[model samples]
Target chain A: MTAWDVIGFLLVLATAAGIIIFSSKQVRGKYPALFRKIPAITRLKRAVGLSVEDGSRVHVTLGKADLTEAANTSTLVGLSALHSIGQLSANSDQPPICTSGDGGFALLSKDVLRAVAMETNTREYYDPDLGYLSGATPFSYALGALDALEESGAKTNVLIGNFGVEAGWLTGNAEKHAQFTLAASDSLVAQAVFMATSQDFVIGEELYAVPAYLAYRPAHIASLRVQDILRFLVGGALLIGALLKSLGLL
Target chain B: MKILNIIIAVAAGLIVLLGYFFRIPAIDDLRGQLLNWAVTLSGVAGLIAILNLIFGVHWKRVKEKHERRGASLVIIISFAVTLVAGIFLGPSSPGFQKLVTHVQVPIESSLMALLAISLVVASLKILQRHRSWMGFVFFLCVVLFLILNSGVLAFTSEIPVLRDFLSAFHHAPVAGARGILLGIALGSLAAGIRVMIGSDRPYNG
Candidate 1:
C-alpha cells in the first residue's frame, strides 16, 4: 500500500477505536443521569401510557436496515426504544408488537421484547412471533407493516431506523388511521424526510441518544459526547484546511 | 445444519470479495460460475416471493370481497399480462422490448418521479419542523448541491467572482463532507465489527 493509503487506514482505525472506547465507557459509567433529563425519553413513556390507556396496541418498526448496515446506530436505538416501550406495555393491558425488515433485526427485536417482558414480570406476554419479519424488499415491507398495523388496531406507531422512499406510504397510512406516529431515520432520502415531517415527533441523530436515556448506559452517553467533540474538531479542521489550501499551504 | 449453513454463507461471501478484488484467471472463471448460480437462485427466490404475494392477496380478496378485491384484480392483471407477454415473445424479442420501452419504462419512471417529488416536499417539511442549526446546514447543503447539479447556474460563468466563489465552495464542501462521512463510516465500522464478533448479539436468538 502507498503511504497515503496506510495513513488513511490508520486514521479510520483510530476513529473506530475512539467511538467504541467512548461509547463503551459511557455505557458503563455516566448514562443514568443523562437518561433522566432527556425530554424525548419522557415523551416516550407518555406515548406508551396513552396507548395503554386507550387499549390500543403499540406499533414498533425497527426499519429494514440490518445490524451490519451503516445505520447500526439506528438498530441500537430501535432496540433501546423497544426495551422502554416493552417495559411500559407490560404494565398495561395492551401489549406491544414489533415488526422488523431484516431477519437479524427481527431476531434481536424478539430478544429485546422478551427481555423487557421478563424484566416487567410479564413473561406470559412474551411471544416469539411478536417480532414479525416482513418482506425484505422496501415496498413489500412497508405494505406488510401497514397491513399489520391496520389489522392490530395500533394506536401509537414508533418507527426508528434507516428507511427509503416508501416510508412515506406507511406514515400516510398510519396518519389516515389516526395513529400517533413518532418516526426517526438517519437516511438523507427525501421520502424519509417526508415521513418524518408527517409524524407527531421525529428524531434524527437524537435516535442514538435512546440507550443513554433509557438504560443510563455510560458508554452510550460518553459516545455521544465523544461524537460531539469529534464533530467540532472535524469542523475546525475543515475550516483550517480550506484556508490553508486557498493560501497555497499544505 | 444451521451452523453449516452459516459457515457456507461466510465462505461464499469471502469468495465473492476475493472475486471482486483479485485478478486471477481461474478465480475469475470460478467467480463467473458462482455468480451465475447465485443469480439463478435469486431468480427462483423472486419467483417464489411473487407467487406468495399473488396467493396471499387473492386469498385475502376471496375471504374479504369488499376491501381487497380491487387490489387482487390489479395484481392478477399485471401478473397475467407480463407473464403471457414474456412467455410468448421472450425477453429479447422486438415485441417484448417494445412493451418494456413503451409501457414499463414510462410507468416506472413516472412513479419514480412522483416519489422523488414527494420526497423533496417532505424534506422541506422536515427543515420547517426541525429548524435546528444542523438541520438548517443539511438543508442548505442539499439545496445548494441540487441547484449546482441541475445546471441552472451553468450560464453564471460570466460573473468572475460568483464563478470563483461557487467553484471554491464546491471544492471546500467536499473536504468537510468527506470528514463527516469518514466519522460516520468509522462509527458504522465499529458497530459492524461488534456484530461480527458477536459482542452485539441482539440477534443471537
Candidate 2:
C-alpha cells in the first residue's frame, strides 16, 4: 500500500469512529442540529403517512445493485431508509413492499422488513412476498418493477438505490400510474435521470443522509456529520491544489 | 448469533479491505478464498431468487386467477427451455447466442431507445414544474448537448460559434459528474468505516 492510501483509510476510520462515539454518548436533544432541506425526504414522510391513512401500499425498490460490490453504499443506505419506512408503515394494513434486483439484497430486504415488523409489534403483517427479487439485470429489473408497481396500484413509490438510466423508465412508469414518486441513487447518471423525471429526488451523498432524516439514529447522523467534515476538507484541498497549479507550483 | 454475524462481517471485510493495501501473502490468499466462496454463494442465492420469483408469481396468479397465468406459464417454459439448451447445447453454441441476441438484446435495446424519449419528456416536465433558473439552465444544457452531440442538426464544424459552444458544453458536465463521483466515493468510504466498526450493521437486517 502507498503511504497516501494508508493515511486516507486511517483518516476515514478515525473520523467516523470519533464521531460515532461522540454522538452515541450525547443525550436526546443535546445532539447538535444538522439539518438540510431535501424535498424527497419530506415527500417520503408525507407519502408514508398518506399511504397508511388511505389504506394504500408503499413500494420501495432497492435498485439493481447487490451488497457484494465494494461501492454499494447506495444499497446500504437504501436498506437503512427502508427499515425506517417499514417501521412507520407497520401500523397500516399494508406495509411498504421492498423490492430488489439482487438475490442477496432481496434476502436482506426481507430481514429488514421482519425486524421492522417485530419492532413495531406487527409481525403478523410481515410477508416474505413483500421483499423479493424483481429481476437480475438492470433493464429487466426496471421492467419487472414497472409492471409490479402498476399492477399493485401502490400510492407511494420510493426508489432509492444503485440504478442507471433504467431508473428513468421506472420513475416515468410510476408517474404514468399516478403514483407519488421519490427517487434517489448513488449513480450520477441515475441521479440525473431522477432529477429530470421526479420532482422529489435526492442527489449525490444526500442519499446517505436519508436514514438520519427519517430515523434520527445517532450513528447514522454522526456518519453524516463526518461526511460533511470530510467533504469540506477535500474541497479545500482541491482549491489549494488548483491555486498551486495556477501559480506553477507543484 | 449477533456477535457471530458481526465477527464474520468484520473479519471478512477487513481481510478484503486491508488485503488491497498490504501485500501480505496470507491475507491475499484468505481474501481470494473468501471472495470465491462469496461468489459461489451468490450464484446459489441468485438461482434461489429466480425460483422465488417464478413460483411466487405463478402461485399468486393461480390463487387470484389472474389472466397473467398464461404469461407466467410461458415464462416457466422459456426459462426451462433456455436452461436445458444452455446445459446441453453449451452456452457458446449458435442456439444460445441466437436466442440471447435475438430476444434479450432487442428487449434491452428497446428499453434504451425508450429512455431517449423519456429523457426529453422528463426535461420538459422539469421545466414545466420548476420554471426556475436552475431548471432553465438544465433544460438548455440537455437540448444543447443533444443537438450538438447527437448530430440532429446538419451543422458543419466550420461554424465557429456552434463549434465553440459544442466543444465547451461537451466538457462542462464532466466537471459536475466528476464532483458527484468524488462525493459518492467519500460517502462510500465513510459508510464502509461505519459498517466495519459495528456502528452501522445492515447485515443485522
Candidate 3:
C-alpha cells in the first residue's frame, strides 16, 4: 500500500530467507526456544505414531482455499503438514487420507499424495481416492467431508487450513468418533470453534510450526526462528504505536 | 524435472510478487498472463475433482454395494440431473436459479443452523472435557462476549464502571482478532518466502 509497508514486507521475507540459509548450513545447534516444545505439535506426532501402531489412517482436511485467493497460504501450510504426515505414514499398514474443499487444492493434494506414495515406495497403498474433493462450498464441505471421513475409517483427524464455523460440525464429529484430533485454521472463527471442540489445536502462527515439529528439517527450524524474531519486532512496534497514541503524537 | 519444476515455480512466484511493487509493463503483463493460467488450471482441477467424486468415490461405493450405497446412488443421480439441467437450461435460467435459491439455499441455511448448535454443544463440553486454564479462559471469554452481545448488559451500561467494562468488551474481540491477524500475516510471509526460495516444496510431493 505504501513504501514503508512494502519495505517491511520485504524485510520479513529477507529475514526468513537469511535464517533459512544460516540454519541449513549449521552442523549442529539447539532448536530455537520458541519451537523447543509445543504440546499440540508433540501430540500430533504421537497421534501419527499411534496411528501407525493401531493401523488406523490419519485424516487430513485442507479447508477450501483457492490458489488465487487470500487463504491460499493457509492451504499451503496445510499441504506442508499433509506432506509430512504422508511420508511418516507412507510405509505403515494404513496410510493417511486427505480431503480438500476446493477443486484446485484437491488436485494439487492428489499430486502430492501420489508423489509421496511413490517416494515412500508404497505404491500399492496409494489410491487416487486418497485425496478427495469433499465439497465445493462451506456447508457442502462439512457434510461431504463428514461422510468421506466416516468412510475412510480414520482414527485421527488433522485439520489444517482455512475453515469457517462449518468446521464445528467436522471437529464435533471427530470428537465423537476420532481417537485423536488436532486442528489449525487461518480463519479466526474456525480457530475459536476448534478450541471449543478439538482436544489439541494450534492457534495463529502456531499452525506454521507443524512441519518443524513433525520433521526436524533446517528450513522448518529457520521458519520458527524467523517467526520468533519477527513477532518480537511486531510486538515492539505495537507497543510504540500504543505509546504514541496515548501521547497524542501518532 | 525437479530442477525444472523449482525453476518454473520460483520464476513465476518472483514475477507475480514483484509485479505489485514494480511498475514495469513487461512484468505486469507477464503477471497477468500467469494469473490467468492459474485460474484456468484451477477450473480444470475443479472439473477433475468432480469427476473423481463421481467415478472414483460414489460410483465405486454404489458398485460395491456398500452400506451407504443408497446415499451414493442419490448423489450420482442428483449430480447427473443437475449437470444435464445446467447444460440444457443454462445457469441463468429462472428454473435453475430457483433450484439454487429454493433447494441449495435452504439446505445451506439448515446446515448453518446445525453448525451453530454444534458450536454451542462444543462450548458446553469445553470446561468439562478440557479442564485447563486456557479452556476456562476461553469459556469465560465466550460467555462474556455472548452476554455482552446479547443486549443483556445494555441496562448496566448506564453505570460508569459498567459502561467502561462494556466498552472494553466491545473492543476485546477486536484487539484479540488483530493480534491473531498479525501473527497469521507474519506466518504467511515466512511460509511464502520458504516456498519462493525452494527450501520447502509442497509441490515436490
Candidate 4:
C-alpha cells in the first residue's frame, strides 16, 4: 500500500480505537458534566416521571441498526436508554415499550429490558414483547411505529439510536397526534434534519454520553472526554489538510 | 434448536456477504438465484402487508369512526389504478408506461421534492429550537448546500471567480460527507453482524 493509504488506514484505526476506548470508559462512569450539559439526558428522568403520573406509556425506538452493526454507538445508546427507562418504569404501573426494525435487535431489546427489570426488581412488569420487531424496511418500520403509537397511546416517545429518512414520517405523525417526542442519534445530519421539522428533542453526539449520564460510570465519562478530544483532533487534521492542499503542498 | 437457528442464520449471512464481494461464477449464480427468491418472497410479503393495511384501515374506519377516510380512499384508488394498468397493458406496454410516467413519476417526484423542502424547513426550525452554535453551523451548511443544489445560483455565471468558488465549495463537502457516510455504513454493517449472531436481540418482543 502507498504511504497515504497507510496513513488513512491508521487514521481510521485511531478513530475506531478512540471510539471503543472512550465508549468503554463512559460505560465505567468517567464524565458527569458532559452528560449534565445535555438537556435530553436530564429530561429523561422527568419524561419517565411524567409518563408514570399520567398513566401513559413510553415509546423507545431502537433504530433499524442492530447490535452487530458498525454503528454500534446507536445500539449502545439505545441499550442504555432502555436500561434507564426500564428502571424508571419498573416501579410504575406501566412499562416502556421498546421497538426495533430488525428481529435480532428485537430479541436483544427484550433481553435488555428483562435485565433492566430484574435489576430494578420489577421483573413482574417485564414484557418480552416490549421489544417489538417491526418490518425491516424503513417505510414499513415507520408504519409499524405509527400503529404502535396509536395503539399504545404512549405519552412520551423517546427515539434514540440510528434512524433514516423515514424518521421524518414517524416524527411527523407523532407531532400531528400530539405525542411528546425525544429523539437522539449519532447520525447528526439525518437526526438534525428530522428534528428540524418535528417536535422531537434531538440529542446528537450526546448519544455517546448517555451511559455515563444514566449509569454514572467513570469509564463512560472518560471515553466521552476522549471522544471530544478526538473530534477536536479530527477537526484540526481536516483544517490542516485543507490548508496544505490549498498551498500546493503534499 | 437455538444452535440450529444460529448456524442457519450465520450461513445465510455468509452467503449474502460472499454474494456481495465475490465474482466467482458459481457464487454469482447462487447469489442471483437467491436474490430472485428473495424478491419473490418479498412480493408475497408485500401482498400480505397490503392486505393487513387494508383490513386495518377499514376496521378503524368502521369501528372507531376514524377521520382519515380520505387516506383510505386514496390508497384504494391508487391500488386499483395500478392493478388495472398492470392487468390490461402489462408492465412494459405504452398504457402502463404512461401510467407510470404520468401518475407514478410525477407523484413520486413531487413527494420527494416535498420531503426535501420539508427537511430544509424543519432544519431551520431545529436551529431555532436549539439556538446553539453547532446547530447554527449545521443550519448554515444545510442552507448553503440546498441553495447550491437547487441550481439557482448557477445563473450568476457573470462572476467567474465567485461562481467557481461556490461550485467548488458545493462539491467539496461531498468528499468529507462521503467518508462520514462510509463510516456509518461500516458501523451499520457491524451492528448487523452482532444482530445476526444473536448477541443483540432487541426485537424478541
- The estimated TM-scores of all candidates read 0.65, 0.93, 0.95, 0.63
Model 3 residue A221 distance off true place after TM-score fit, in angstroms:
1.5
Please report, in order, the local distance difference test score of every candidate based on alpha carbons. 0.64, 0.82, 0.84, 0.64
Give a tens-digit lDDT track for model 4, residues A58-105: 888877764445565576568767876777777686788877665555
Q: What DockQ would you assign to candidate 1?
A: 0.17
| Per-residue lDDT of model 1, residues A1-250, tens digit only | 4576566556444544655665564544654333335554566667778888888888898788854445656766687678767776776766788876766566667778777776788887676666766555676577777876876788888777778777776675677664577766656552235433563544444555655555554445555665566567767887899899999996
- Tens digit of per-residue lDDT, candidate 2, span A1-250: 7898799678866776666665675643576755978777888898889899988888889998866776577888888889889878877978788788898888888888888888888888888878888888898788888877876778899898899899988987788774588898998889888878887788788888888898877778777778888889889999999999999996
Encode model 3's per-residue lDDT on B1-205: one tens digit a residue.
Answer: 8899999998998898877677689999999999999889888989999999899889999899999999889889989988998999999999999877888889888888887887788789899867889989998998888888899877986899979978977997899999999999988888888888788887763
In TM-score terms, candidate 2 sits at 0.93
Question: What stretches of model 4 exceed 4 Å from their correct place?
Answer: A1-36, A66-73, A177-179, A199-204, A239-249, B1-146, B168-205
Q: Per-residue lDDT for B1-205 in model 4, tens only?
A: 6567667656665575565555668877877776677556545544544444445444445456667666556666776788787988899998789877897567556655766776656665776665778667767787788888888887777898898888688777777666555444444433444434444333323
Off by over 4 Å in 2: A27-31, B147-169
DockQ of each: 0.17, 0.65, 0.69, 0.14
Interface RMSD of each: 5.8, 1.7, 2.0, 7.1
How far residue B143's Cα lies from its native spot in candidate 4, in Å, is 5.3
- Which one wins on lDDT? 3
Candidate order, lDDT descending: 3, 2, 1, 4
Selected candidate, larger TM-score, 1 vs 4: 1
